[model samples]
Target: MGVICYTSGTTGAKPKGAMGSQKYLVVAGEIWCAVDNWSPEDDYLSYLSPAWATEWVLGLSSGLRSGTTLCFPEKPETVQSDIREIGPKVVFYSARMWESLNSTIHAKIADTLAPFRLMFNSSLKIGYRVIDARFQKKPVPLSWRALYKLADRLVFRYVRDRIGLSNIKWAYTAGASISPDILRFFHAIGVNLKQIYGLTEALMNAVHRDGDIKPESCGVALPGNEFRISENGELLVKPPACFSGYYKDPEATKKQFDKDGWIKTGDAAHITPDNHLVVLGRMKELIDLGDGNKFSPEFIETRLRFSPYIKDVMTFGEAVRPFVCAIVVIDYENVGKWAEDNRLNYTTFADLSQKPEVSKLILKEVERINSVLPDWSKIRRYVLMHKEFDPDEAELTRTRKLRRAFMVKKYKDLIDGIYSDAGEVMVEAAVTYRDGRKGVFKTAIKIRDVGGA
Candidate 1:
């Protein structure tokens, strides 16, 4: 069967479902099982966006080939408790999703359950070490790693027991880059979370392996897949599992493949001396400053997001532009901690974000990161969000990828406010919670002047 299915385009505009052949689907499953080294005893959690191809094959076909029980939670809220209930041998977690999981579990039951053998996440924000640093430290009296395992045994093991993953042997983060904090935390807690590199078009480009986990590298290319770095630092592939062609869309299909059957990926990636792949960002997302300095918006955002106060960001500039600017959302939990510890008084997220003292604090953090970046890559101006983005509202996809077009439209007024001469701008918005409840709220957007990078 051949039918056109849309792609989940995260850049430029809404995704257009492209046509794909059933052979493409069937072959993907065949390639992944062999390359991922799927075993009969392996079990998995299908939590990724199935609308996407690679995840769809891995969740359905590969799971079947591996002869593992596939588990799906009844509801989003049931995910954590269900994982403990099912204890699937492997997992696929997104960076933001895992961060939310880390936030909820840490805020609620971190010390209780923190250990499992074969846990894998698909999206990683930073490394696991970065995650552990976010919380208060507890003194332990065992193998440093074992103690974290015990925390999981105490708290997360019930989750494993409940989910039937009491014996997770390996874990992986696919699709997108995950935060360093989440990666480090899971590994610190006993999940052997590693990075896997590939895209929907080309299924198993590389497996990064169990013992070969690197800090940010996406691992090396798999055996039959051809990989190379272009002069512009882009990644080009010729995988055996690569698609025959985009179904029926010869124009789009021709745009991707080159002579001799090479598929040119639009993503920017580089190889470490060790030959591991370190993904830079989407080819289209690079911010080229007028001064001729180019930087990845994602890289900048990842570093900025590490700050407890900054939650969301959109950095834009062209090579010929004078400066860079962004719209940022505040991270309330860490920011609130800063306020309480310092005895700063604030009644709400809005108040804390707008406070001059808070702005100064964030400014210093921004500057600290900017100092490490090239001059053109620095953030020049920014505005703070009164609240976090909600997924159910469609600002973020089910897997938590920012719908840039959706966000740009939704926050058009606040974004414009960043450029206004007025010292502060107030915006009226419709907000929703995870529970699907909705409400209208008005909040002032605070703009801060950031010195150049």
Candidate 2:
């Protein structure tokens, strides 16, 4: 019997899980075996939630069937220590994880490294490698490439060493779209990262090849990949090594499977001039900005999240407004580093975000992004969330998706406070303290002036 895992359904949408038979595992095993060129001596780790379909296959079965020693972190905060201890030959993470790591790295250091290869992506973007070092900003007078090689060796090598990514041969990323800055940083450094597109249903459909890695496209359909575009621009796929069907939800299975046996992926895609596939946005999540202009939340979110301080973001516009608005979450550790680097004093995340200087920084960033976007698609107004998104809080699913519907309903007062004229907005929030006591705080959030992007 095949196991099935659904899309978390956090977007107020229906949940549909991928179903596959024993053959799903069988073919996935074959693809996994050859893709990374795994060996009996490899060590791999599973840091993703077991409930996610990608983890169920790649993080679970791929490691077991291939003889890679699979390890899990004892605690979430200990992921770095675990990676250093295990020194996995292969690594995989979601776009969020990559974003978090990249944010942490960039906020702290912008250096270059020696030519040791480290793969660095989930699935959202790909074809990057981080070397064991980082380079400093210096004007290379001549063929300074030689000097950069020296600086990478002497200075940047410590970066990968600190993160225990010295020996990583391959890294994979997926789930959501990765920020362009984050994607460029890794490849520019020397990590062998590349894009791979797959769903729980089709499993692994498109993969970047050794020579055909394109930064903008997901890559060509794999060796046995078959695909077509529907009249509405949806991508329909069939792959030999992909998962076949849902385990038991025959209704979902029937809904996803076409009469011709192609798996109907609700995501839209287009074949580029170079033959690579560029995924647009989900068919379901399209937002109309009330001006007959459509905005892809994923697209807008990707741009907003390009700000290193933004760790998580969700925008709402749909049928309500002429422009988009957003809920922003800051990555505390990184923002904390920013605070320290600039000697900006703040007691907590709320304190830091509410500071006029910090608020201006975010405003400047938002405006920078909005300037290029059409007015209807731009994020006109935003609210900095005082409370961080956490899985235990139910604001996020186990896979770390923003439960937009849940959050919109649960934090209705907070969301409403953004549009209110009170410059300072207040809401009562219940949270579990570190001491395990439950308490409620009437938190106050200060709205930031939205600038052009």
Candidate that would win on lDDT: 2
lDDT of 2: 0.68
The 10-residue segment of model 2 with minimum total lDDT is: 123-132
Candidate 1 residue-pair clash tally: 65
What TM-score, computed on C-alpha atoms, does each candidate reach?
0.77, 0.83
lDDT of 2 at 327: 79
Kindly give the stretch of ten consecutive residues in candidate 1 with the minimal lDDT sum: 117-126
Tens digits of per-residue lDDT, candidate 2, 140-166, equal: 344345544554565445556666666
User: How does residue 4 of candidate 2 score in lDDT?
Assistant: 66
Over 4 Å off, model 1: 2-5, 18-23, 105-166, 244-248, 306-310, 319-321, 332-352, 355-368, 390-398, 403-422, 431-442, 450-453
* Residue 139 of model 1, lDDT score: 36
